[model samples]
Target chain A: MARLSLNQKTTDRWSVAEAVAGCVRAGLPSIGLWREPVQAIGVPTAARLVADAGLRVSSLCRGGFLTAADPARRRRALDDNRRAVDEAAELGAACLVMVVGGLPEGSRDLAGARERMAEGIAELAPYAAGRGVRLALEPMHPIFCADRGVLSTLGQALDLAERFPAEQVGVVVDTFHVWWDPDVLGQIRRARGRVASFQVCDWITPLPPDALLSRGMMGDGHIDFPLLRRAVEQAGYAGDIEVEIFNAEVWAADPDAVVATLARRYVTHVLPD
Target chain B: MARLSLNQKTTDRWSVAEAVAGCVRAGLPSIGLWREPVQAIGVPTAARLVADAGLRVSSLCRGGFLTAADPARRRRALDDNRRAVDEAAELGAACLVMVVGGLPEGSRDLAGARERMAEGIAELAPYAAGRGVRLALEPMHPIFCADRGVLSTLGQALDLAERFPAEQVGVVVDTFHVWWDPDVLGQIRRARGRVASFQVCDWITPLPPDALLSRGMMGDGHIDFPLLRRAVEQAGYAGDIEVEIFNAEVWAADPDAVVATLARRYVTHVLPD
Candidate 1:
C-alpha cells in the first residue's frame, strides 16, 4: 500500500493517543502528532500507543516559533525545540517540522524578525540532528508572513536550506501556505528530496484580525491538491504524504467521521501510484 | 516636491474626470487609472485630461482575470486586455498591471488555473508591447487566492517575470499584498528594475473574513514601509512608489485628506534615499 500519514491536528477532536490509535485502526500506515496532543496524554504514553500500533510517526507537528525579542525567551524556545526533537526521535519520527515564529509580538520589523527566525533555526538544526531528527522548516503563506511565520515562500526556505546540507535542514511545502505561490513548482523541483514533509489543507479567510485558528479541509476550499502532490512527488519526495488539516468545523465534528471522509478523499485524490 | 501618483481607484469615491482634475490640482505628479474609471469617463477624455494636465500615468490598475475555461470568453478577456493596453497607451501609462485571474468560475484546478493565466499573459504581452505598454503582473495577498489573484508570493511573480523580459513584461510589487513574504527581500532584489511599479498600502486585519477591502493606510498598519522601500531600492528598483490603498474608510474621507495623509506618511516613512 502507498504510504499515508494523518496529522493529529486533523483529528484534534481526539487526544494524541486516541488520534494515533484511531489512525492505525483506520489502516493509515503512518501518523503525525502535535505537541498539544502529546502534552494532553503525556509524550511517553502517546509514543507508546504509536509503537503499540506499529504506526510510523512521520513527524512531530512543530518546534519553532522563535520570534521573542527577549534573548532568554528565545533561548528557552530553542531548548523547548530540542525537547520536541527529542520527543520526535523517541517516537521514531522522520522529522521535526518548524513553523518558525512570525514577527515578534507587536513588532513590525519583518526583516529583523526573519533574521531572528533564521538564527533560531540554525541554533536548533544541530540540536535536532543530535536528537536524530531532521528539521523541516515550513514557510507559511504570505498571509501568515507577518506574525505567524516570517518565512512565507518556498524559495526562501530552500535558500535557508542551502545553508545546511540535505541531511540536516529541509523544507515542508504545505498546501495551506504555498498553494498560491507562482513559483511553487520550480521551488519544489529545487527542494527534491530535501522536502521533508508535504501536507494538505485549504486556506480560508478568517474574520476578526486575530482569528488565527480557522482553516478549511483539503477540497472544501480552492487548493488543487492532486497537482500539489504531483509537484512534490515529481521533485523526488518519497516521504509520507501527511494530511495536516487545521479546520474548526472538522475539529467540532465526529473524529471518526472526519478520518473516514479524509481516507476516502485521500484514496481517491492523493494515493501515490 | 517629490512625485505622487494617484491610483484612480482611490478617487473611485469621485467621478473619473473630477478625480483626475482634483489630483492634478493637488500637485500630484502622476496618476494611475483603473479600467472602470476609464470606462466611466470614456478612455479618450480620461487620456485627454492627463495629457492636458501633463500628468504621467504610472500604470493601469488591471487587465486580467484569465481563469475562464471557455475559449471564447478567455479570448474575449485577451481581446479586452488588448483594449486595456490601447487605453493605457492613450493615457501614456507605464504598464497594464495584471491581477492574473483566480480559479475558473466553478473549477478548483489551481495549476491549470495558473496555466490559463500564463496563456492569457503570453497572448496579451505582444499586444501590450506593440502598443508601447508593458504587462505588469501583480502578486496579491494570499487571502484572494481563491476568488481573485492566485499569484500570492513575490517569488511567484519573479518566476513569472523570468518568463518575459523587463521591457515587455514585469511585476508590480505591492507591499500591502507581499510585504509578508519571507523571500520579499530576495524577490525584490531579483525583481531589480523589472519592477514595473511599487505600490504601498497598509495591512489591517478585519475579523470574520471581510479582508478584501479592509486595507489600511500607511502608518496605520503593521507594514514597515521604510524597510520595504529600502529592500525594493536595493533590488535596483528606481520607480515611483504609488499608494494603492483599498480602504473603505480612507476612501469615504475627503479625497484631499486622503491624498494629503498619504503624502505625509510617504514623506515620513517612505522618503527615498
Candidate 2:
C-alpha cells in the first residue's frame, strides 16, 4: 500500500507557507497543493518550500472544467489546464487532477455538455501527457451532476478511460464522491491501472446548501473507510489516499491542530498496520 | 401510454378536493393523492370525494420506512406499511410506493441498515401483493444517501427486486430522484417490466439544501423529459408519467394553477404528441 497524504485545502486556515511547514513538521510523507495557494506563494517558492521541507507531491489540486458549448471558451479552458499541467510538472506531482465540469451554463442538454467535456479533455490530454503530467479525471458525486461535474459516476469515467487508448488519461477515486455507488466496487476493479489518484473523506449524512464544497472531515460521516480503502487498493492503485475535505469549521481551526488530528486519524483509522 | 397524472402535493395550497377538481377541470386522466388531506377529511369521505370527482387514482401517497434497525420499531413500520397497503388498495390505486427509511434514527451504519430495509420490504411485499397493491420501491437521490434511503440508485432497487421474485415488488422511476445518474438511461432500460410506476419532475441546477423533497416542476429544471420518456417507452414501460414535484413553494401556490400548468407542460414539453 502507498502512503497517505494531506490535501492542502483540508487545512485552509494556513497560508501555503504555514501549510507546507506544518505538514512537514507533522512528519507527513505526501501532500497535494491547489493552484490558488501555489500561485499566492509563487510556484518556484512553493516547489522549493515543499522540497526544502521534504514533502512528496501526491497530486496537484485540479485542472479541468471543460463543458462550455462554445468552441473558443472550450479552447480557453484547455489553455488554463495547460498552465495547471505546467504547475503540476514543476511540483513533480504524481498527477494533474481534472474535475470535468457539469452541464454547460444554462444548457439543459446534459448529453451536449458531456460531449463538450469529452472533446475539451481530449484536447488537453495530449498537452498534459507531453509535459509528463498524468491527466486525472475526477468524477464528482451525483449531487454535483448539474452544477459541478457531468461525469458523476466512476462508470462514466471508465467509459472516458476507454477513449484514451493508452493509460495516459486516468481517473480519481474519491470516497466522498463514489462511496454511495452500488457499482463502485466493480468500477474500481475495472479502473485498475487507469486510476491516477485516490482521495478520502467522509460522506456526511445531511449535506449543507453549498454542497459543492461543504465536504465532511474523516470519521465525521457515515462512509466505511476500511471497505473503501480495500476496494481502491485491490484495484491496483498504489497511490497515496489524499485526505481532501472542505469543512468550513475545520478550516477555521488552527492549522497545526488540523494537520496533526488528520494525520492521527488517517494513521489510526484509514491506514492498515 | 397510461394517461398523465398530476401529483396533488406539488400544489399544496388547496385541499385534496381542490386538487382533484383542478385535475378534472384540466382534463387530466389520473391523480396522485396524499395521506394528509385524507386524514384531514377522514379517509371514507375523501375516498367518496375523489370517486365522485371522477379522478383516477394512480397511487396512494406512500408506505414503507423500513429502517429503524430495532425489530420493535421495524415491526411498527411494517404495521404502518401494512395499513398503508390496505389504504392504497382501498383507493383503487395502482401501487403503494415506499421510500424505505435511511439509517435508523440517529444511526450511521448504512450497509446494515440497508439490509434491514430489504428484509422489511420483503415482508411487506407479500402483504401488498396479497392486497393487490403493487409495491414500488422509490430509490432516492444520493444526497439523501445517509439518513433517507441507502438505496440511492435504481440498480440497487433492481438488485433488491430479484429477492421478492414477483411482479409485486417493482420500481417507481421519478426523475427528481434519478436525473443526475450517469447510468439513468441504462437503468431505465434495465427497469423494463419491473417499473411499477413512472414519474417526472426536474433537476434544478443549484440543488437546494433539502433535496429529498425540493423537486422543480417538469420543464422548470434541467431534466430532458421527452428523452427520458422515450427511454422508458423504449424499455416497454407504458405507464403514467406522474409528475411528483415536492417543492414547498410550488405547494404553497394556487393548487389549480399548479395542476393546470403541469397538465399543459406535460402535453407540450414532456409527453409525445
Candidate 3:
C-alpha cells in the first residue's frame, strides 16, 4: 500500500527474475531496473516478467555516458542510449535515468564535458520523445563530478532539462545527490511538472573507502527524508518513490530483507504526514 | 617572482620554524600558517621567525566551527575563534580562513546548521576587523558538507560574507573545492573585491580513503588552474596564490621536495600567462 519502489542496485545480488519476484513478494508496487540485468535477461523477457507480475517499471537506471573525448565513443554512447530508450519503452518505464559521464579521461575541461552532455541529451531527447520515454537527468553529487557525473546540481540539470519539452526531458530529485545543495528546495520547486522521478537514500559520514558506496538506508544518515519528500510532492511529482541505496553492507544483506527494510523506512521517514 | 604562498600543510612534516625557513630558501615571498603549528611555536615566536625570514603570513588556516548544538560549546568556539583572530593579527596574516563546521553531531537540520554558521560569522566579523584581520569564509566541496563544512559553494559563502563589510568578511577561492562548481567562474567574478585569498590544488579522482587527504598537487588532477587563476585575477584579487594541498603522499614526501614541486607546478599549471 505504501507507494514504495526498490531500485535494483539496492539489491545487487538480485537477478531480473529474482528482483521482480522479490518485489512481488515484498508487496512493492514497482521496481527501478538497471539496463545490465534487464539486458542480461533480454528486454522483451524482462518486460514480460514485470508486466506479468503486475508491477510498474518505475524508471530505467541509466542511459548516459555522453562525455567521451573520442568521436567514435561519443557516437557509440548515443547509439547505445537510443537502444536504452527503446528498452525503457518496451518495459513501460516512466523515465530513463541518466548519470551523465564525467570529464573525458585525462581531460580537465569541465565546461567542455558539460557541453558534450548537453549535446548528447539534445540529440537523444527527440528519439526518446518519439518512443514516449522521458529522459531524467540525475545530477550526481559534486564529489562524483570528476568521474561519475558532470551534472552536479538539480539547478544545472533543470537548466539543461528546461531546454527540452517537460515530457521529453526532466530532472531526477535523488536525495543522496541533491540534499547538500543549499538551493535544492528552490530548484525542486522550479522543477515542478519536470520532475521525472524521485529517489530516496541517506548520506552517511566518513564515507566508504570507495565514495560510490557511501549511500546508506533512508533513516541511517543525516538526510531529512520527509523534508525532501514534501518538496518533491509540492513539485507536482505523484510518482513511485524509488529507494536507491548503494552500499557494500546494504548489498551484502539479503535482498528481501533490504526491500522490507526500505519499505519500513519509507513509511516511517520518507512518507509525508 | 610570482605572488605565490606556500601553505604549511602542503609540507605537513615541517615545523613552523622550518616552514618559514623553507619558504625563504625556496625564494617564496609568503607562507600560510596553521593555528596548531603557530601555537606550537608560540604565535610571537612564529611571527618573529617569518619576519626574520622576510616572509609574509598569507593567511591563517582556520577559525570557525560554530555549528554547535550546545550553547556552551558555541561560546567556546567563538572564544577559540577570537584567539585565532589575535594570532592572525600577531602574525600579520591577510585573513583568518574559516572552515565553518558542518551539521552538529546527531543533527540533520542543514538549514539550522547553515544559520548557525552565518550567526557565528556575524558575531566574529567585528572582532576580526578590530584586530585588522579579515574573516575568509572557505566554501568546502559539497562532499565535505556533511561533516566538515556546510558552506559548499562560493555563492553561499558570498551570500554570508556580503552581510558584513568587505573589509571584515570575504571568501576564499580554493581551486580544489570550487573547480567542480559549474558556476564557479561567475561566482569568482562576483567575488571581486571580497576575494580574500586564492588557494590552488588539484582534484584527483578515486579520492583517497580519507577524503580529507584527497587534495592533489596542481598538475596531478583535473582542475584547470590557469583558468581559475585567470578568473581570480580578473576579479581584481591581486593576492598571494597559496598552494594548499592535503594529500597523505604529499605529506610523506620531504617538506623541501614538496615545496619545490609545488613551486614548479604553480609556474607550469597555475600561474596565468
Clashing pairs in 1: A102-A147, A207-B207, A207-B208, A207-B209, A208-B207, A208-B208
Name the weakest run of 10 consecutive residues (lDDT summed) in model 1 chain A. A205-214
> Listing every candidate in turn, what is its Cα RMSD in Å to the true structure after a full C-alpha superposition?
3.3, 2.4, 0.9
DockQ of each: 0.47, 0.63, 0.88
Write down the lDDT of every candidate, Cα atoms only. 0.80, 0.82, 0.92
lDDT of 2 at B183: 77
Residue-level lDDT tens digits of model 2 in A235-268: 8878787988887777788888888788777866
lDDT of 2 by residue, B30-120 (tens): 8888777767887777778788987788877788678887778877889989988888888888888888877665565667888888998
lDDT comparing candidate 2 with the true structure: 0.82
- Estimate candidate 3's alpha-carbon lDDT, on a 0 to 1 scale: 0.92
Candidate 3 regions off by >4 Å? Answer: none
Best by lDDT: 3
Candidate 3 chain A has its poorest 10 consecutive residues by lDDT at A264-273
Query: What lDDT tens digits, residue by residue, belong to model 1 across residues A86-162?
Result: 88888888888998887666677877887888888888888877877899999887666665778878988988887
Best by TM-score: 3
